[model samples]
Target: MIKNIIFDFGDVFINLDKPATVNQLSKLDSSFCVSGKMNEINEAYEKGLIATDAFVSFYKSKFPAINEASLINAWNAIILDLPEYRLSFLEQLANEKKYRLFLLSNTNELHIEHVINTCGSDTFNRFKDCFEKFYLSYEIRYRKPDPEIYKYVLSENKLNPEETLFIDDVKENTDAASALRIKTWNLKPGIDDVTMLKDQTCFG
Candidate 1:
């Protein structure tokens, strides 16, 4: 029986366009592209190795044509929307107390700030309240697909791998969790929805 559930943020609970950032940035300046180094910078930033100001400064220095606001806007273009029905479903799960719930996502400060601004504090807080623990990459200094992060969560919470189920839109992430003996649902963005967890056959 699955007694614990770990969920990914983007494309799972909230709708997202993974390539939205690059597309949006290209509009601001054709030269503003995520080069190899920026990819590394992104990983570092998500892992909390780099501070928010420093991260933004790196972008400003790299792309002097665009102002900070525009850069931030393009960066946040990935976060699309969260459906109210999903929130209602999650709240029902939280209220039932049937399983310990958690949120884990590889995200940075800027994107999160945008999420707060877009969702409004009340809705965001209420959604957050549903989770027993809300873990973000920047705040936790750990991102998914990394063995350490999963181990940290499992060990810290004293959760059994067999009893825990992880849900992520990325197959790579779900594969990593599965390797650790944790059950997983490789959720499909458009075809699968988190709100259908109970109805889904994967849970069994």
Candidate 2:
């Protein structure tokens, strides 16, 4: 029986349009995509290899012609607001205490700041209180697709791997967790809904 559930924060919970940000950045500077600077900056930012300020500085330095405000806007274009229905679902699950719920996201400070601003501090706080443990890659210094991150969660919680269900939008992240014998759900966009999880027998 699944005794724990791991939720992914991005597309699995809050909708994120990856291409929208890339397209916006491309509009800011055609050279961003052409020069491959955007990819370099994002890779460094997401991996926690660079601080938010340093990441912004690196982008600004590369595109010295572009203003800092525009660069900041382009960088922050990824985050979208959290819907109310999803928030209610999470609240219900937490109240029920159906399983030990945890949230694991491969996120950074800037993106989180954007999320907080978009979702509002009160709502974000309410959402946060629902989880037994919350894990963010930047804060933890360990990212998804890295086995160590999953291992860290399991070890920190003292959870039995076989009794835990890990859900994520990305296949690679779930695959990593599954390797450790954790039951996983690779939530597909528009295909999987967290609220619908209650109807499934797989989860207790």
Candidate 3:
């Protein structure tokens, strides 16, 4: 009996070109890989441990040839379209009020800004209004696959792990949630659409 639903924003709802940023950056620096100090800096930024300007500055310092605009564009290139059908499904779910709905996403400021700018304020607001609690990684200073963040969400909402279902595109994230006794759907991007929730037995 699932009484609450937790969702991942990317892939599960909004589409993302997960490899676009890497590809774009690789063009700028042939040896650029998501490793070493870069990964640490990204984690720090996602955790809201650093400001947006600091993040941009760090990249600027590393890739002097790349201008701020180019860096920002490459960083945000991963964000793509948010299909209307998904939004419609979410809006319907919200209206039904059958269960507590929440959004937990590992996102940064620039990406969020891109989403707002691309999706338009009214559409974005509609999507936001669907959630009872919207947890942004940067804003919350917590991220997925970190058990503490899941614990915090459960504790704050007074939700029972047994009665909650978390849906995410990442297996690692879903695995972490499952470790806490929360049911999860590790949805495959192309094969599993969020709009097809009724097909999932957990929801049934």
Q: Give the distance in Å from residue 70's predicted Cα in candidate 1 to where it truly belongs.
A: 0.6
Candidate 1 residue pairs in clash (backbone atoms < 3 Å): none
TM-score, predicted candidate 3 vs. hidden true structure: 0.97
What is candidate 2's TM-score against the reference?
Answer: 0.93
Better by TM-score, candidate 2 or 1: 1
Q: Could you give the candidate ranking by lDDT, starting with the highest?
A: 3, 1, 2
Write candidate 2's Cα lDDT for 1-204 as tens digits: 988999999987788887776687678777766357766666667778888889888877877888888877776787777989999989988898768999999888888988999999999999899999999888888888889989999999999999999888899988899899998888887887877776656565
- Order of all candidates by TM-score, from best down to worst? 3, 1, 2
lDDT of 3: 0.93
Instruction: Report the C-alpha lDDT of model 1 over 1-204, residue by residue, as the tens digit.
Output: 999999999989889988988998888888775689998999999999999899989999998998998888888989988888999999999999999999999999988988888888999999999999999998888987899999999999999999999999999999999999999999998899998898766588
Model 3 pairs in collision: none
| Candidate 3 residue runs with Cα over 4 Å from true position | none
User: Can you write out model 3's per-residue Cα lDDT over 1-204, one digit (the tens) per residue?
Assistant: 988999999999899999999899999988676767888999889999999999999998888888999999999999998999999999999999999999999999999999999999999999999999999999999988999999999999999999999999999999999999999999999999998887898776
